[model samples]
Target: MGQGPSVIDQATFKEMGLLSWAIIDLAINWGGWAVSAALQTDKFYDMLGTGSFLTLALGSMAAAKVSHARKYLVSAMVALWAVRLGAFLVARVWKVGHDSRFDEAKKQPFKFWIFWTMQAAWVFITLSPLLLLNTASAGGPARIVWSDGVGVALYAIGLIIEATADAQKFAFKMDPANKGRFIDTGLWSYSRFPNYFGEMTLWWGIFITCTSGLSGAQFVSVASPLFVMALLFFVSGIPLQDAQAKRRWGDIPEYQEYRKRTNLLVPVPKSLFCGASCGPKSQ
Candidate 1:
């Protein structure tokens, strides 16, 4: 019903995001430690904090060698990406003050507990790769490999693309004229969620780099990418955004038309037809 700059300020958005993360972290960190201690071992290593553990794990496996540089590189790159995404989300949450989804659920005690607790679980599980890499590993070759070069290059490209896409979206939203409109410009034009695509690719590159040095358990670390994809697609990324879009533009004939033509997650060419399969028809 409204089309204008959000009344919500940036500071409030940041606070909401940070508070959500903080609440989730509190539940995971303390709950995880308690559970692990009771179990007498870190049985649920996957449930530890974010992928900071992956950093430590990779470092341990690499040991003190030339290849150790590769682990450090991977760790540094991932840390940067995580911090950047976290900060961005925090800013967005602050801008919105409180997420409507959270607010709605807050009225129901069971739903509130479950939602926040599950988010904490998701955060921990999703961050396994980084956490493992951060933990003390045996260390690796004291020289970098050709694989490291490729990994670094891929990661750099992914980060650049993701960062650019995010910036473009932010700038588009900041422009008052574009209020309540979808962004289909720059990298966004190429892919509906270029940022997410890049982020998913970045983790794969990191995983490849981390696994390049080893044989057994290292290969199993594919879980990191898998977890990220699941969370992004099903939990944090598209579904939530889509729901918001539907709420905002459900009554707009133009938006309904756009939704039919534009790709939901992956970027694709606009369709010429406006059939049921294409999506809800424009009024």
Candidate 2:
């Protein structure tokens, strides 16, 4: 019988694959960074993130000759998410004229560079599952499994939650009566940061989808969801938004009351989780 492939060969392939992907991340993010920093503008910063996701997903599929239905499934989910979120951000930024998040950061060289690099890291880590899936040695098409169905269902639920919340918020903002008011109705009533929750949920769905094709070390791609959770909970997403919310609505009694009652991430009703506090205030 012929000898099995050496451990050295496998390790080499893995390192090379990761290096290639890193190169792609840098090319997209840093390249965009150079332009944005030079122009002193952030109009396209969010687009860069989405563009990186789409570029790498499709490009990796092409590069690897990925014909497996499982791989295509992963790529398609990524494409759908990247496009939807990207379009929303682009439109919102255009309407608002500028992103408050980048106001000072874009002016400082180190801060701006960190923004791009961190974004690259975010893209690489978030796309790890799909990247690993597509780059793996293909064994032809795969049959749809229970896991795939579950993944698709979770993805659908998350996407709907995120899209609906965004649309609802947009409508509320458009109403002249809501000029200075915070959104506390619809999905916002369920969770203070339902969009973030939805974002995390959808990524977990992608991770689960990739599991059908992942094994051994490849399973480390679970970092996709974990990194997102950490970013939102600890690092960037929730913390920044929460701070901004506090600055804007902290002094309002209604906002403070809502904050005290609302779940921070999950959409569970306060009444379900709280006993007496969730009850209506006494007159």
Candidate 3:
């Protein structure tokens, strides 16, 4: 906004262009992983994963010749979400000393490197929409479309839901009385994985915001949200958590009952009034 040639208009991007930009982005992502892998600590993965996306989005905008309000707004949203998520996860790992998910992976170099590569992929794929929007030449000055308003609203709701769910779960875990018990209160009461739901929703909202500006091959960026949903639903998020819960409480009648009534990712209205039936069944 202040001065200098826009990143998109710069001679380097003009000559080498998006392909070069993409290679640089890949380097940043892999570089972070390389550092983390050398240090042998997964602590930075969460922070770096989110931070890289923010960097890519903002960096692309900074390179562009034209400054668009929509681009700026999307950048701000990404920054806010990434910061909050990174800080939250970092604090969590700090408290726990280490993430057990890396236990076996870290012990094996090849597997661990694969994990880092996957993180890089996750960053690149999930952020495709914003990255494409920031670099695309189709749109002018970023007008406020109906999709933008709706997308922003969705993002806000998802952020609140995710934050609330995490806070509630954290609080529950802190209490001695709730020891060994799974969280079925607050947002968790409605969905087995409310946090994942919020995450998916927010990404979907982000994708929607980029829709109006997208044209031609740019539409392929819609894979951003779809990839997120798949990752959560089948790959990493839900399956892991669900298995953990099963190991911990599967034999208990209450947990089985809770699993039966509660939706997997979407919150159900019946969750509010279903009470005992919807809640954990008694031991």
Candidate that scores best on lDDT: 2
Tell me model 2's lDDT, rounded to 2 decimals: 0.86
lDDT of 1 by residue, 114-213 (tens): 6546656555455444444433243345577776677777778778878888889988987999987888688766466778878877877777666655
Which residue pairs collide, candidate 3? 6-63, 6-64, 7-63, 7-64, 8-63, 8-64, 254-281
What would the per-residue lDDT of candidate 3 be over residues 9-65, giving only the tens digit for each residue?
A: 566653434565567667776786677777788787787777777777778777655
Q: What Cα-based lDDT does every candidate model obtain?
A: 0.60, 0.86, 0.79
Q: How does model 3 score by TM-score? A: 0.87
lDDT of 2 by residue, 215-283 (tens): 889888998999999999999889998998999999999999999889987777877888788888899
- Ten contiguous residues with the weakest lDDT in model 2: 7-16
Clashes of each: 49, 0, 7
Say which prediction, candidate 2 or candidate 3, comes out ahead on TM-score. Answer: 2
Displacement of the residue 112 alpha carbon in candidate 3, Å: 0.9
Ranked by TM-score, the better of candidates 1 and 2 is 2
lDDT value, residue 165 of candidate 3: 86
